[model samples]
Target: MGLNKITGILPHENTCADLVPMAYFYDVLKNIQKVEEDIINMTYEDGRQPLLVHLDMLLTIARKYPNTAAMCIYELKRKHLKDTFEAWWERNQKKIPKKYRTGIRQNADELFDELFAIKSWAKSE
Candidate 1:
């Protein structure tokens, strides 16, 4: 999906209630990546072909993180959020596709899980 399509799903910023819902939108993106990686490695087929749903979800997730990160920076301006996010963004820039680089971030926990799974699978085979 395109950036505009996913951003349209974000809640209207008229009420305080929008905060949690917007955050949950990112959470759904995270979960989609989780399942995507699971499917990629577990499905017995051509590895080159990615699931279309996963690709759509990834683009959505990629498109949403900047807003999420910016919100995080605002909420935790006094904390290390800005610096930490910058560092993460810089370090992982190459790993993320160009579409996601502008907005969304890679979910660290999901990345780690995928790495561990790949490692374990490699050892087993």
Candidate 2:
């Protein structure tokens, strides 16, 4: 995606329209999931850190749009299923050198599982 397209999707940090409707927010979530999948599937030697970065970005976006039902369900499931993994990821980041973190990054397959589960939960309403 182009930089302009990305900027168009996300709101300004302090905007009054922060809570976009559930449908609109789901669209953004879907795109973020697609980008995350691409990052995970990237096979180059330097792909993992970028993948983690994208995952972090997606988390941040979810937080920003917390009022949306789809985002809410996604976040709740994420907190339940991956909260420990996320904490581990953060702890490891501080404990391990940045160079070594990539080797221990979350796998693409696991990410797909979580993403699909969240998608399913979001659609159940």
Candidate 3:
């Protein structure tokens, strides 16, 4: 299904718009269950990766936007659902994602450093 546009969409600090990528991920999960091989073989027009677009992009979206919505309560629901998905997928024969050194990296370095004060010494000196 080549890139197309249709949204049954949400919002906002004065209409601040956003898209929950995890929604796409939920659809992908359904497809994975229905046709695991087909989902695994799928590709995107944009480019390629070690895994299928669904595995890489949609799964990454699952990580990035884990929650179905922006509210705190929704995050809790997402955590539970994600945990369930992980347990279910673990039983499948298909291989899980592999992270080579060249694979996509999370934009989490500064957050981790700030959380652990990894660079706090620099500030004092």
Candidate 3 — what's its lDDT?
Answer: 0.34
Give me the displacement of residue 99 in model 1, in angstroms.
24
By lDDT, highest first, what's the ranking? 2, 1, 3
* TM-score of each predicted structure versus truth: 0.29, 0.34, 0.27
Q: Which candidate is the best by lDDT?
A: 2
Which portions of model 3 show Cα errors greater than 4 Å?
1-19, 37-51, 68-125
Regarding lDDT, does 2 or 3 come out ahead?
Answer: 2
Candidate 2 residue pairs that clash: none
Query: Across residues 16-121, which tens digit of lDDT does each residue of candidate 1 receive?
Result: 5446645654565465445444443444232222333443443353345435433332222212322433444455466666775544444443433332222111
- Tens digit of per-residue lDDT, candidate 2, span 71-121: 455443344334434543553465556676555554533553544444423
List all candidate RMSDs to the true structure: 15.8, 11.1, 14.4
For each candidate, the alpha-carbon lDDT, in order, equals: 0.40, 0.46, 0.34
Residues 19-71, candidate 3: write the lDDT tens digits.
33545656655553443333233432122222233334444544455443222
Stretches of candidate 2 off by over 4 Å are 1-42, 69-99, 102-125
Point out the worst 10-residue segment of candidate 1 by lDDT. Answer: 115-124
Pick by TM-score: 2 or 3, better one: 2
- Lowest summed lDDT across 10 adjacent residues in model 2 is found at 39-48
